[model samples]
Target chain A: MTPHDLKQQAQQQLAQQASLDWLSLPQKAQATFAALDMPTRKTEAWKYTPLTALLNTPYFAHTAAGQVDESAAADRLGQLGDVSRLVFVNGHLHPGLSSYSDLENQGIVTLFSNANDAQRELINAELGTAFEPQQHVFATLNYSCIEDGVLIQAPTDFKVQQPIQLVYLSSGEAQPALAQSRVLVYGAAGSSLELIEQYDSLGETNVFHNQMTEISLQPNARLTHLRLQVEHESLSQVNGLHVKLAAGSHYEQHALAFGSALKRNDININFNGSNAYCRLNGVFLSKHKQHIDNHLNLEHGVPHCNSDTVYKGFITDSSRAVFNGRIHIHKHAQKTEAHLNNKNLLLSKQAELDTKPELEIYADDVKCSHGASIGKLDDKSLFYFQSRGIDRATAEAMLCLGFVNEMVEQFPNTAVIELARQRLAEFFNDVDQLNHLWTLE
Target chain B: MSKTPLLEVKDLVAEVDGKTILNGISLTVNPGEVHAIMGPNGSGKSTLANVLAGRDDYEVVSGSVRFKGQDLFELEPEERAREGVFLAFQYPVEIPGVSNMQFLKASVDAVRKHRGQEELDAPSFMKLAREHCKELKLKPEFLKRGVNEGFSGGEKKRNEILQMALLEPSLALLDETDSGLDIDALQVAAEGVNALRNPERSFIVVTHYQRLLNYIVPDYVHVLAGGKIVKSGGRELALELEEKGYSWIQ
Candidate 1:
């Protein structure tokens, strides 16, 4: 089936749902989506990442919420202590399985249905304005089939003391399903928040998740975001994270993601005010016919703003990965300091990495640099390890994991780092050549 | 006691990129002996060490090597190391993100487990490693750093010696371990090696100059020219080479 037919089927399925307060949002977005066409091979953006598997999967129908093993989901993702966590099982919020009572009491974490009048008004205003609609057809397709989502709004100068976590766990039922989740975070002036988004397959099922996370920071507000997507060979996920930073606002994001049958992430950041800063660092691992595409765009609209990006990828065993990072500096954006770099390691005979690090500067006096490097594991290092009684398989695993652990160590929180390490150990061990090389904490 | 040589290499020929480096090299090492191999540039000194350590780039065209009455070339590199062969690299590789303590722990545990010995606890390993660090003039902080990361030339040599001491291999082939060290660091490295010398261990010290032999004196010296050992003599041969250079050897 073609993408247009899938979109038509999705719209029909969405129209048949019971009328709700937020139904107008998707109805308005369907018109917007209709104006855009699906990307084909001639489309420069989707040339390398083919969408055959996603289209082949019979996933237009929504799965009725089945029996979800709450405890098993919690066990797979161990405790990251004392944080406000919201658990979403099969596209709906699972309140009994979540522990955000304190945050709810603070009136910061609320469901969109239960949001107060003012908060609802803000959501209505800022839902779809995070990015230009034309350039991002797939990401913009999220609102057309929207369902229930969370609204996290911090009052002016009200800082969140602990990190807020949104866990999207899919209990892929026997039938194929389409799972959509959304989140809108507005950090008021002088407010701060640390948000963690974790996506995992709750069971062995066929599911396609279209997830969106949009964050807007007011003046002097701060946000630290972390994203993790553990490998699920049977899963297909597309995520768009749009962030807008006001004057004196700081935004930092660190992600450790993996590729599955198909995975794409479109991250767009707009600096609306001067003196806003952002630092993005992450690592993505792909193996065994998996495909991952990361497209990042940073726009420096104002002067005296700064942004830096460092993304590393480890591709092995016939997998494919694509990375495109662009930094755009406007004409009046003077003194804008932007640097973007991407480093990759191809550890197999057939693994592939296609990277393009670009910088477009319209200003005369801006400091910007971008570069990309793709390489293999050093042979001398491998020999050094083998000479020390470390087997070749273990040595290769160590080197590959070492390439990623360099970024893992830089993660800001210890609990998040622990979880990353645990998942990494498990992921690496699953590879055929990587065996018995884990030293977990 | 058995009289078999600790290591026996006969008619060993090896090459890299189709260029033969070790041409018909023959040697024998008995227990409790240090054999120094002195050669000028392009004389296959390091090739011998690499082949003995089972590096992949060097192809052994034809050779017969036996260690403790077992065929050496039949085992993989790690298997060779586990079977009591150790090579102190002339240029140690600096591995980032893996701490020196972790690297040593993994190596030590692998060797110990292969020998049917119990793995040491973290505290126990730390104590053992710290003592070796002090002896090699390395601060305890070096243990927490990445392996050879940002270390000076002399420090990398000391780290190699520290590893040799911990692994305690029966056959140690040191390839120019004293190349870039200062006199003081050379002396410290030599002392560290001498401390690991035992009755059952054998050493093959390969170098270009005789400066290191002054500290860790060898029992025998061999001069290699064009991938073949042309002359063999006692300790005084090193002195003669040091005084007159390879011109005197020919």
Candidate 2:
């Protein structure tokens, strides 16, 4: 079927389902999706990340097909250690494989399918308010097909001790399928929460994942968000995260991704009130024939707000990557401090990277700077290592690790840091020349 | 008793970036003896030192160098380092994010493994490193920081000496180790080198000024002019050259 027919089919299927109280938003979202065109190479924001491969693929909306093995689910939860977990298999919540029975007693943790009347009212009011449907087509598509997702609410003066893990596992073993997932998080005044969103696949099946996460932080609230994406080569993913901050609220994010055949993450953060802060740190690795892209936009609309960002990437073999970071400071937002830097290392002749760091400031008293650099290893540093009895290959591996480890050392969780280190070692081991140099033991 | 020299250089010619820097230079060093090479600015003293360390930037158009009955040019830079050749650089490279302790451990272990000696464990290596740092007047905390990163001029020179003491090479090439040091720092650095002297170790000290020669006395002094050894004599030759300028030698 053509791409247009596919969208019509998805919309018609959603309209035919039993009309519920939550179906109103999806109906409106369907209209929005119909009015907008799919992103292509001609689109200004998506010039570097062509959507031809994504649009041309013939994929049907996901339906519950195969069963998830209990043992396999348990094995996939390796070493995350004593934390609340919420598992979703093929866009549906699996309560049998999930933990966190007491989180609802403390503040609020309820799935959309099991939410109470009051929780449902809150979800309906705040669900699709963080982002505009007419701007992002994938987000609109995600909302048009949304079925069930998680809604987390930390009430006033409440604090969560353990991190909450949202695990999205794809088990589309029967046929090529598409999955759409949604997450809405609310932090009330003087409350805090730590959330980790993990995406994985079970078997070697062609699947496309479209995900959207909307977060609203009330005054004096704080949130720490960590997103880890590690999937099989047969999977393609498009993720969007939209966050809004109030006065005296702080939001920090760290994203680590191992690129699939195709992956893109779009993050938008806005400072809506004064005396707010945000920091974004990311590290991405792409190998073989994979492609990865990261686009971040930070908007400072009020005075006395600060934002800092840094991203590093390692591309090898025939892989490609793109990074575009833009900071916009409005005319009245004085006393704003913003900085961004992107650095990349290309390990092969065929590897490529396109980076653009932009700053648009209309305020007179603002401090904003952006820089981007792409280059290979330094020859003098390599020779310095060789003079100390280290081989060239080993020296290269050590330098690359040191470059990426500068950001990895800042991870707040020890278990995640260990996992990231192991994954990096494996990536280096797969390269032909650096195989023997990176050893975890 | 007469014995083979520890290092022998016969008519070495070297160039860098298509320009000849060393024109037929020759020198000999015996075990337990220290030789001082003094020259004016841009007189090819550093070129000779780098060429000995197998820096690929310096091309040896025609040369022959023998170290303990083996051709030195046959090995790579790393191989030469494993075979007991140490060059104390004038300007040490700063490598951020790599702690000095880790770099030193790797270097010492590689040399020990090559010489059929057991690798030092962490605790024992720390003990040895502390002793060397004490002799060099460097703080023990220097080992925890990045290698030569944000280090002062005197500190970098002392760190280089500490490495020379730890590796314990048969032949140590000191290239302008006292150029930017104050009097007290120069004394400490010279004493660090003096403490490592033994019957089985030799040193080739390359310097421009006669001030450093006062602290570390040499058995022989040679004047390198126009990339050739024009004058060679006992230690008093350094004093004579110090009284008159390098122009007197030519």
Candidate 3:
């Protein structure tokens, strides 16, 4: 079908779904979705990734309700543990599988649908302010379909002792499906919250998950956001997170994206105040024909804002990965320090990684540097391990683990770091004997 | 029958690029002896170390190196490692993301597997590593940090010796590990090396300075120049060379 036909059909589906309060949104959101040019290879941002496979299938327009098996959902929720879980199956709230009463009572967590009018207005004011509407199509689509998601609000001077886990499960029955999620986090001054976002797919059907999360941090507010995406290999997903930081605010992000046929995570940060710190750390493992892309941008708009990012990619088989990070500093943003580095290891000759780390600085007083390297394992290190008698395969495997463990260990949360490590080990477990030639090492 | 030399190097003619570095060199290292290969800056001391470790850079034009009855050249670097041949690189590559414990475990397991031994579990490995680190005076926290990353000149040398202690290779080749070290670091590194010496394991201590020999005193001293051994003598040769300098050797 043509692009116009697809848009028309999607609009019709949304109109038929009366359970969703679609008319409440500003009229401009509908126009934004209508005008979105279906991403193709022709688009510069999606140049290396082609959307031909996604366009070929018809996705069931996401509705307010769908079939959600509690047993299957619980199985997926088990991975996140009992830490304040929020479950969404096939784009609908599976409240039976969610438990966050402690957070609700403490006034730290409030679902968007259940929030008061004042809280709703606060969330609406902060939602689309950080992310630009034109650049990201997925973010625009989420904005248009902003119906239900978790709204996290940490009161001023309150420090949360436990982590809040957000779990999303995409279970497609027959036709391909799509889900749009909106997450708004407002951390008041001197408040802290550790937020975890996890995605898991129950079935093998092709599903598309589009999500947008907006975070606004006041002065001295510390936020740690960990996003783990381990969905079915046939799913296509795109998650966009936009963070706005004030003075002395700290934001730490650790993201691990392992599955899905086509996956991309866009993180855009605006450093608006002084003494703000942000770190974006990620580890991505792709095998088979999976493709994962991470597009991150940090705008250092004010002085004395520091940001550091390290994203590692390990691709095997015919899989592909892309890491594009741009750190922009304005003219008046002096003493703005930012360092961005992207290192990728290709385990297959056919596996591809296109990494571009860009630093656009207009201030001569700022310290901005960016570097990207694409290579295989360290042969000298491999030889060092092997000369002692470790086989070539085991040596490479150990090196690969060490490579990813470097980033995983940076996670401040102990349980999350350990879980990520376990998953990483299991991810590499199959290649017990990784071919020496398979790794760049 | 002289217990069959643990390592035999016959007319080892190896070269880097088009220039011959180890020109017609030959040596034999027995299990119970410590051999010091000392030379000046341009002398092919490091070349011999690299060649013995089976590095791919050097081309063995026409020669043979044997370690424990195995064709050293026929094996890969890791294979050579498994057969108990270890080289203490003068400039150990700093692997930014690999930790000291992880690297040591992998190396030890490789060597053990090659000798038909089972791998050590976490507890045993940690216990073993901690013992070695204590003797080396290295902090236990170093095990958690990346290998040689942000390490001082002396720390890298100590780490190398620590690795040697863990691997416990039959033949350990040390290549100019004394360079860029102060007096105290030299003693610490030397003390670590001296502790690893045993009757069944031999060491080839390659250095440009005779100071390292003060602690890791070798039983045999050989002066290497122009990629070949020019002179051989007892342990006193190290002290004599330190007194007169390598200039008189010509």
* Candidates, ranked, lDDT: 1, 2, 3
lDDT accuracy of residue A214 in candidate 1: 89
Top model by TM-score, which number? 3
DockQ (C-alpha based) per candidate is 0.50, 0.41, 0.53
The digit string of per-residue lDDT tens for model 1 on A234-306 reads 6787888899999999999999998888888999999999999999998999988999999999999999999
In candidate 2, stretches whose alpha carbon ends up further than 4 angstroms from where it belongs are A12-24, A50-56, A64-66, A114-118, A157-159, A203-205, B36-41, B96-113, B116-166, B176-195, B206-250
Residue A166 lDDT in model 1? 86
Cα deviation at A1, candidate 3, in Å, is 3.1
The per-prediction i-RMS, to one decimal, reads 1.5, 2.4, 4.6
Chain B TM-score, candidates in order: 0.98, 0.98, 0.96
Overall lDDT per candidate, in order of appearance: 0.86, 0.82, 0.81
Error of 1 at A439 (Å): 4.4
How would you encode candidate 3's per-residue C-alpha lDDT over A408-429 as one tens digit per residue?
Answer: 7777777777566555554555
